[model samples]
Target chain A: MRAELFLQYLVSGLIYGSIYAAVAIGFNIIYNATGIINFAQGEFAMLGGMIASSLASRLPLALAMAAAVAATTLVGIGMERAFLRRIARGGVLKMIIATIGLSIAIREIALLIWGESVRTLPFFSGTEVSSVGIAGAHFSPQVFWVLGVTALVVAALTAFFKLTLIGKAMRGCSANREGASLCGIDPDLMVTLAFGLSAAIGAIAGCAVAPLTQTHYAIGTGLGIKGFTVAAFGGLGNSLAAVGAGLILGMLESFSIIVVPEAYKDVVSIVVLLAVLFAKPSGIFGSRAAGALKDY
Target chain B: MLKARNLEAGYGPLRVLKGLSLHVAPGEIVAIIGANGAGKSTLLGSLAGLVRPTSGSVTLRGEDVTGSRPERMLAAGCSLVPEGRKLFAPMTVRENLELGGYSVRRRLGRKAFEEDLAGVFELFPRLGERQGQLAGTMSGGEQQMLAIGRSLMSRPELIMLDEPSMGLAPLVIKQIFSAISALRSRGKTVLVVEQNAKAILKIASRGYVMETGSLVLEGTGQELLANRDVQRAYLGKEYSSIADEREGR
Candidate 1:
């Protein structure tokens, strides 16, 4: 590829990578706190995208995104209360089965409600060329949204964990369930709260990125797999590490067009995942057990 | 004050506390001494609402509290420092205490919580010093101190400690036993279960001997210490468990 083409790819990869980072952060939170990979996370994203698309048809861009995220968050809360609460005590086997079943069920419901056709977000930025270079590599407002929102999510999540009592309680529950109970924390409450928080974040990412990739009901499986792979490649239950890994994966996928075909980009992330499993088993920046997120 | 009458409790199908009965007066130190698997821990678990009793009642201050949720009981002024010194290992000593006092702190204003925090620190100076140190990284003795201190944070009217001296050095055990006694002097009631019968009786105002889910003996600390049957069974070789068995003959 020529220099201009390479620069374009670089810019595109960096922007896409930022969106992946936000999604990975949400995955890490649920995985760390509940010891279960909520496969429906991508569905949350898809829901956000769909909701944003429908709302933006009439409402302002920012307001549409907000409403979409709020609606998806409520869906997450309902899923936790309806599905997770009953099956939490169903042990590892039953809970795993329940979540897997719920994932399929959610995907089907999305397809039924939103239809199987892909839907794109409306033009958030007017048709304006905002570029300084002679090549006119204009920056779209969608690209800016993806980059800025990812940074904000990371900062907000970090602060919540550090400064809040409820956040500490969630951490405590994740570390040791029996001991947390002894400390007077209700483990069930913590688990439900975590699910709710993770879902909301997933929705935000979905809504933010919809204007670019659009969303379809059947899109959940591929996105869900990518989110999990990104999370696992980084560190199964490490939020910061997951975000970093997601960005790296995103860049790999976007940049592979130069060295090889676009398909080869995913190969980098997959290889990293295998290497971590074979060598460290915990990925970078994670402990052996990574059992931090299992109980509450 | 606390009372357990006809307290029949068990883990699942197997009964552990078979019609066991005991009581403690206000500002009293009562020790329950028994052999391993003597249902001592089970009794405490039932009292703490960690285990459900098959039958019988546990009353605190003449109020029926059998099978109450642990958190509700904790807020109602009943706290248990469970076996194995179950502190949040990843958390610091202060975090552990904060969790202990979580329910209590909800009712008190910020200032009162701070004062109570200081009071616990006064009782266990090491906890104050190690506030930022992870509970898991602390030595066995220090963890034990933090466990007791954590229970104190709840400001429970009745503190039930399960084997506080387990796995600790001899010196540490002495310090812990002394601290239990000090709680009584502070007008707080304490119920401790221990295998060290001799040391327990020394500090307790009254004592009960449990064996395989039954209360075998109960009396003043001095009386039980002198009984012959108790001498043969527990109290070790250093002191006879009991002087005689006064069975109805």
Candidate 2:
């Protein structure tokens, strides 16, 4: 690729990374709050794409996203209460299998309802090819929205966890469930809250990326795995690191396509994940977040 | 006052506490001494709502609290420092303390919360010094102190500690014990389960001995410490010979 093409791809990849960052951070929330990683996370994101796409065509642009987020939040809460909570508290292995089962059920249900065919993902903003000249290159408005949304979500989450009482209680559960209980904080309720919060975040990400990629029921599996990779890449519980690591993964995956065939894009991401696992085991930013996650 | 009546509790099918009964009066310290699996921790767990009692009642100031959730227990003037120093490891010492005060009772007003924080800091000045330090990074003694101090943040009428001196220096144990005494002096009721019997007995106003999930002995500190059987079996045989003579070893 020429220098200009390379720069453009790099920027586009960063934007894609922002989407991953949003989804990956969802995994981080539940992983931190409870030791269980909700494998059904991607379904919530997919719901975002579907709901937002349907509503965006009719409702005010922002309200459509809100409705989508609210719906996914309830899905997340139902998934936790109806299924995940019971088996998860038993053992780590049981929890893992339970989440996997939940994922399969979610995917099948989505397939039954939405069908297997890919559907269009509507953009949140007007799809006019708005451009900006930066130094000598132009960037798309869509890419800028992706970056802006990720930043806003990150900022909001940081504030919630740091400042609010319920947020602090959630953090208390993440760091030390028993200790939090001793302090009059209900770990179980907090775990449930974490799932809802994560679902909303995942839905927001789905809404953000829906216009770029078509929606499909089976898409949850790959997206779920990718979200897990981003969580692991940043360490299990750290939100900011998940964001940073996600963008990095996205950029690498997108840029890799220039050298290898597009068919190998998925393989490149998996390979990089393995490399990170082998190199840091904890992740690139794993140690930094490790402190927050030790109790779980 | 706090009381447990015929409390029966266990995990799955294994019953750890079998009809155990005990009571602690206001402004008093009660030490519960037992062997490792004598259901010492189990009894505390039941009291803290970490375990469900199959048949029994826990009452604080005449309120039936059996199966009351941990958060409710805290709001009702009952706080427990669990077996391990379960500090929010990633959180700063101040954050840990702040969370400790998460109770409806503590939400009375700003002045009350501030008063509680001040009281906790006064109890463990070391925690005050290391308020900004991460809990997981602190030393065993410091963490133990923080655990106690964190529990104190709730300003409960009854503070129950499970093995506060489990893994600490003799000096640290002394500090923790003295703090317990000071707490009593301030009219707080305290219940402690400990393998560190000698020190626990020394500070406790009264003591109960448990053997295999049953309450075997109950007396004032001096009475139990002075009993030859109690001294040899639990209080450690130096003060009396009945335990040694009975052993025949």
Candidate 3:
């Protein structure tokens, strides 16, 4: 491949990688708190994009994005209060299945409201024709936006978990629910917060990437699978590793165009997911002993 | 400091605690000794609000707190060091201790919370030395100390422990009992359940012998320790005496 093309692919990979990393982090947050993989995680992104795009017709872009994120967060909290919390007594498998049902329900609702038409938020900085040139490679400025938002989210989340009382309490619930409750930390409240936080992060990623990928009701399913692949590739509970795994997966898929047709690009992710599951079920960064102790 | 009346609690269809009742006065160390299946842990669970009692009343510091939930129990100044320690294995000792103070941290203020942390470290200097170490990486004895220290961080007026010597060496058990004894000096009420009847009764001001789901004997620690039935059932003195006689020792 030519140097310029390589740089373009790398930038493209980084943009998509940041979005995937955000989605994977969403999965990690909920999984760590509840011990269930929330399949509706991707729909949170779709909701953000769709809500923001609709509001963008009448409101400022930044306001629309912020409102969309806040609204999605409420939806996340509602999901927990209405479905997850009610069915929590049914065990982890039941809760996971509920998330799958929720994902479908959310997608159908999005279709009902937004229809089949594709939607996109206006670029934060410039139109589609506007591009930034970096080292002979030209890409949309939204790439920088996506990268920036992901980095900020990661940093903020790290500080929240490390420095704040609520964050440590949430970690307490994740480490041991019984122990946490005994310590006067409400497990239910932490789980609700986890859902809200995960949804907000996913929404931010969705809004940031909307101008580039365009939003459709059906985008959630694809994003959900890809995000899960990245999360599993990193390790289910480890968020930092998910970022690296997302970038690696994104780069592999982007560069696969050199060897395979565009139609086969998605095949790369599926292959990687299967290979990781079969060879190292714990994740790339997780030690074998630690992996053995965890329930995939 | 703590009172339970007609407490009936169990996992569905299996009645573990059948109308048991007990009380612990302020600044007293009360011990409950029972066999493995006597529902001793369930008793602590019900009082700490981890397990909902089917029918009962738990009064703490003159307030009715039955089935109030664990956080509420903590708010009422009651804390339970649950069986097996249940430490947040992935978190550091300081973090574990910090979380134990979660309920009262705001009320205690930052300065007071730090004092509480310092108090826990003072109680278990080993924990202080390894403040940054993960709870799971500690030895069994150290983990027990961390568990006790974590509960103490809450500044609970009433602290309940479930089997503090469940799986410890003789020396470690002695260390744990000494710490429990030390709680009395600090003016904290302790309600402890133990299978090690002999050791617990030594430090316990008062003791109860539970069987099935009811207290069969209640007396001062010295009286229970000298009771023939308690010695036969829990201390194994009768069996040891019989073996000695058979071997002509």
Candidate 4:
């Protein structure tokens, strides 16, 4: 491959990779807190993009994005309180199925509200024609926004889980719910917060990538699968590893177009996901002993 | 500081605790000793709000906290060191201790929280030295100490321990019992359940002998330790031989 083409693919991979990483982090947050793979996670991103674009006409872009994130967060909290919490004793499998139902419901509702037409947020800094040239490759400024926001979100979440009292309590809940409750840390509250936090992060990623990928009501399913693939590849429940896994998957998908047709690009991630599941269900970064202990 | 009255709790139809009642006064060490299936752990679970009572009341510091959630129980200044320690294995000792104080942190403010952390470290200097070590990586005895220290971090007026000596060496059991004795000096009330009747009865001011979910005998530790039935049922070969001889075996 030519150097310029390779740079373009690399930039494209990084952009998608960061978005996948954000989505995987969302998965990790909820998984760590509640041990449920929330299938509706990607819909949170779709909701952010759709809501922000709709509100952009009436509100400033930044304000619109913030409102969208907040609204999505509320939706996430409601999902937990109204649905997940109610059937919590039903065990993890039932809860996972419920999330799948929720994802379909959200997608259908979004379709009703936003129609089938694709929408995109305006470029964060410069117009579509504007580009920053590096070496021989040119890229839009929005690429920086996507990368910067993802990095910021990762750092903030890392700090939150590591340093804050509530964050430690949340970790306590995930580590041992009964133990946490005995310590006077409410597991239910932590789980609800997990849902809200994951949704907020998802929304931010959704909004960041909207200008480049364009938002459609049906985008969530694809994004959800890709994000899950990254999460599983990185070793579920390990967020930092998810970022690396996301980048690797993204790069593979981006570069796969050289050998396979663009239409078959999605096949690359699916193959990776299947291979990881079959060969090392615990994930690439997860220890064999630790993986054996987890339910996957 | 803690009272449980007519408590009826169980898992499904099993009925582990059948209308059991117990109380611990402020600054007292009350020990409950029974066989493996005697529902001692269940009693602690119900009192600490881990298991909801089908019928009864749990009072903490003059407040009727029956059937309240665990966090509410903690907020009311009651903490339980559950069976097997139940430490957050992945977290550090400091993190575990910090989380134990979660319910009162906002109410007590940052300074008090820090003090409580320092106080826990003081109680278990081993924990202090290994503050950065993961809870799961600790030895059984250190983990038990961490569990007790974590409970103390909440500054709980009433602390309930379920089988603190379940799986410890004789020396470790002595260390844990000494720590329980020390809690009385600090003016904290303790309700400890144990299968090691002799050891717990040594430091306990009062003790109860439970069998099949009912307290068959209750008395001062010395009286219970000297009781023929308690000796026969719980104290094992040495005392059981004496009791057996008294009963004409």
Evaluated on chain B only, what are the TM-scores of all the candidate structures, in order? 0.93, 0.92, 0.95, 0.95
Two-chain DockQ for model 2: 0.68
Report the lDDT of model 1 for residue B120. Answer: 83
What is the lDDT for B75 in model 3?
86
Candidate 2 overall Cα lDDT vs. reference? 0.83
TM-score of each predicted structure versus truth: 0.91, 0.93, 0.97, 0.97
State the lDDT of candidate 2 residue by residue for A123-184, as single tens digits: 55556466666656777666677788889999999999887667877888878788898899
TM-scores of chain A across the candidates, in order, are: 0.89, 0.92, 0.97, 0.98
Candidate 4 deviant stretches above 4 angstroms: A289-296, B238-240, B243-249
Supply candidate 1's per-residue lDDT for B215.
88
Which 10-residue span in candidate 4 chain B carries the lowest summed lDDT? B236-245
Candidate 3 ranges beyond 4 A from true positions: A289-296, B239-249
- Model 1 Cα lDDT, one tens digit per residue, A4-55: 7776777687776776666677777776677877878878888888888888
lDDT of 4 by residue, A1-296 (tens): 89999999998999999999999999999999989899999999999999999998899999999999999999999999999999999999999999999999999999999999999999888889999998899999999999999999999999999999999998888988898888877788999999999999999999999998899998989989999999999999999999999999989999998999999989999999999999998899988755443323
DockQ of all candidates, in order?
0.42, 0.68, 0.68, 0.67
Better of 1 and 4 by lDDT: 4
Q: Better model by TM-score, 2 or 4? A: 4
Model 1 lDDT, residue A80, Cα:
77
Q: Give the fraction of native contacts in model 3.
A: 0.81
Interface RMSD of 2: 1.4
